[model samples]
Target: MSGAAGGALAGKRVMVPETRELEVLARMLERHGAEALRCPLVAIIDAPDPAPIEAWLRRFIATPPDDLILLTGEGLSRLQGVAQRAGIEDGFLAALRGVRRIVRGPKPQARLRAVGLGADLSAAEPTTAGVIETLRAEDLHGRRVGVQLYPDNPNAALLDFLRGAGAMPDPILPYAYASKEDDARVLAMLEDMAAGRVDLAVFTSTPQVRRLSQLAVPDRLRAALAATRIAAVGPVVGQALEAAGARVAVMPEDSFHMKPMVNAILAAIGTPGSGEAA
Candidate 1:
């Protein structure tokens, strides 16, 4: 999908709830002449204790699971950091290279590329169900599988599926979400949206949607979301927003990424010259 041209979104007020690439998303909107309301909802941090992560890395290096499922780019990146800090970066990378890497989405693929690696299998839908579907065709009986997980979710579904398929799943959570600190800011942003100040509210991760839902009452949250246009980065995020009683007005049909999401946003709210809602 093509991105919006410079000045396309002039006078538009787009609320961004991203954390990791808050500036990047803001600049993308700014480049399109939109005012970016930066309200980061969650902060990604390393696991509070590194001992468990270090142990996982050591076990991974020693055994080298036959299959490694990467759920998020941040998870892989965090694992890499933990491995480096433990002075086992090479061993970790070597073990990673030995396994067949399966990615849930393009982000994980991008992360793999950063480490001079690539995904051997990619989910068709970029969701947990997609991951399960992708692995369904494989011969996983008694296979050792390493699962990279993120914060807040234990992904019992994926683990149960793996166990049902007779695969031994070893899951590792290398990072955690620090979102409690941002509750006040997120609630303020919700109030802004409720007041019809925010033209569009963009969500890039499920955690952002969850955080908003957690901070606001259901009726109030739904009312606030109804006052503004909502844009989701992918189906997963879109589903999360929908489940939270918010309608997703904009989303990329194909590539689920930042640029595609920007393009979708531009399409939903026409350019300045088109005389749409800003």
Candidate 2:
């Protein structure tokens, strides 16, 4: 906290997560004197039930396609566990061995390499637009496309677009979101926000936006969200914030991590702290 958030935030309190999962980020914020709000926005869950995914994995590995498109590192990691559990890791890799792998970014690429799969292509920009361009560039039209998707990915639109362009897109969803379950607390936070009790907000994933939207927040709170400057970790989350009408004020260029995200936020606020450029 002695750095930017600490240097400039020694007196300002910012919200950290209450779940204690974000202890690292929270401590950094606290160092800056910023109050860390510990309320969690969303909880990570395993893919819904795993039964359906097991069935899909069985079928997919039985007759693995010629291409594998990975949309997230987490999904790939989970699929590895599912594969190992089914005693089909060998079969899965055999089916995927010669197949071309398309990853959304570096993280997924690293995951694929760990599984002994080589990436044939990775989205240069890490967004839907980047995916489409990569697909087009690789002449993926009419080829079997397998996509590992996030629980709340808005890839429905991109899938539709791909099919319209004559590409066969097979999207395998690895997870589903069960609401955050802290409904009353989220509502209260929304109320406090509307009352101008909160200062800033941080969004790390797109799913958080959909989760918040499900609350049917009051018009005034929504308005306050629009007025409040938001910190986003990456393009996908930024797009989600935009969809929810939050004006994004800061973002990092590469990885969606706390350090860079906090740096971006500090710069945007012109905070005289450790991260602000001289």
Indicate which candidate wins on lDDT.
1
Per-model TM-score on C-alpha atoms: 0.94, 0.82
Question: lDDT tens string, model 1, 87-168?
Answer: 9999999999999999999999999999999999999889999999988999999999999988888999999999999999
Q: Which ten residues in a row have the lowest lDDT in candidate 1?
A: 269-278
Go through the candidates in order and give each one's C-alpha lDDT: 0.89, 0.69
Give the TM-score (vs. native) of candidate 2: 0.82
Looking at model 2, which ten-residue stretch has the lowest summed lDDT? 12-21
Local lDDT at 84 for model 2: 84
RMSD of 2: 3.5
Once fitted onto the true fold, the runs of candidate 2 whose alpha carbons sit more than 4 angstroms away are 1-6, 16-21, 94-97, 113-118, 164-167, 253-257, 276-278
Off by over 4 Å in 1: 1-6, 272-278
Steric clashes per prediction:
0, 20
